[model samples]
Target: MSTEESPVEREDRWVLNLRGMSVTKITVDFRLMLFLDSDWEVAFDASVDLSYGTAHANPSVLLSPESQGVAGALALFGANVVSAVAFKSGTLRLVFDNGHHLTCSPDPSFEAWQVTGPRRWHFASLPGGDLAVWTGSGASES
Candidate 1:
């Protein structure tokens, strides 16, 4: 066997727009993290969160805190994800494992989650590409 190294593909943060992305996996922890591939990763770290108007239209989707146990967060997982859409109102739409579709609106007063209480909501690749996250801490119980 020949010894060789393959290049790792990475997206430039300065030019990435996460909309319409086909996410392979997701993990819940200090951040709502997404793995574009084995080597490309992006996340919504709550510590530096800028958006906080999180609202949940459905709980079964990516915003399922009931499914992500804080005591044992490592077990949390997501497969076959669709990055969906983002609205100026701060609502982000997504499709998670098992075809769960949800819209999240991050409100700072809702005990607003960040990885710091956070979730990977949407990333828009526009004139000045943008990224958004929702709180993973206070998922709507209703």
Candidate 2:
């Protein structure tokens, strides 16, 4: 199916927008899961550094747990994701570096899931500080 037509056939999806605080500089660790169909799935993890001057961050090499790899997927979607969290159930969550969080999950018309925790931020000072986020959704077949 064409890209334009794909959304019509897909029953669930979401778009997330994560914005950085007004701080001059900050780094965020991102983890995303791409739920493609029932059996196909992908995950991405990376550390992104952003500054006041630019919207897109310079991403650093991290770990990705997917058979095809994160690079390929990013290339495919042309996603320079500033911040986003998408789930199969169409739920989207956006969290800030300061532990503030927002979530959107509707009823049967897609958008069903949850996001929890800032639990703790390790570094909080340097660029190497530990940052993490999570997203959980219902299984496709479930």
Candidate 3:
């Protein structure tokens, strides 16, 4: 075999890296705020779903900030995120190490979700159902 080094493959689909980052804080008010350990925060005013693994796959959908659905996300406090991904279609999904999953879809009229992270990285779901992504280096719209 020839000795050669290959370039590291970049992840084009994933917008945020939450793996191994625990949820440090959660604020439920007019909007939802999920704070990660490493200066990462996600805020959204749109509907969100929390699925509790296979045994309880279907959980109540959070429609508004006053719906008391905050109880579901409370379980994630201090829970480490196993995976977090954002699709090109402006859909966001987060999987916790506790086997719970959270999802947020784009809103037609309002901005669905926004994720801000370290190094000035910002990703958001546009009002028209598109994505506005800004990396540490530059900004890219999708």
lDDT against the true structure, per candidate, is 0.35, 0.29, 0.75
lDDT of 3: 0.75
TM-score of each: 0.36, 0.22, 0.82
Per-residue lDDT, model 1, residue 6, is 23
State the displacement of the C-alpha of residue 79, model 3, in Å, after optimal TM-score superposition.
0.6
Q: How many clashes in each structure?
A: 19, 1, 0
- Candidate 2, residues 2-68, lDDT tens digits: the string is 1221111123433322222122221122444433221222332332221222234433233232232
Using TM-score, rank the candidates from best to worst: 3, 1, 2
Predicted candidate 3 versus true structure: per-residue lDDT over 1-40, tens digit per residue: 1021211113545535677889899998878899998688
What's the lDDT for residue 43 in model 3? 89
Give the candidates in order of lDDT, highest first.
Answer: 3, 1, 2
- Candidate 2, residue 114: how far the Cα is off, in Å: 16
TM-score, model 2 to reference: 0.22
**Colliding pairs, model 3:** none
Positional deviation of residue 63's Cα in model 1 after best superposition, in angstroms: 4.1
lDDT of 1 by residue, 22-103 (tens): 4566666644655653344544332211111233533232344433433222222443434434443333444444444433
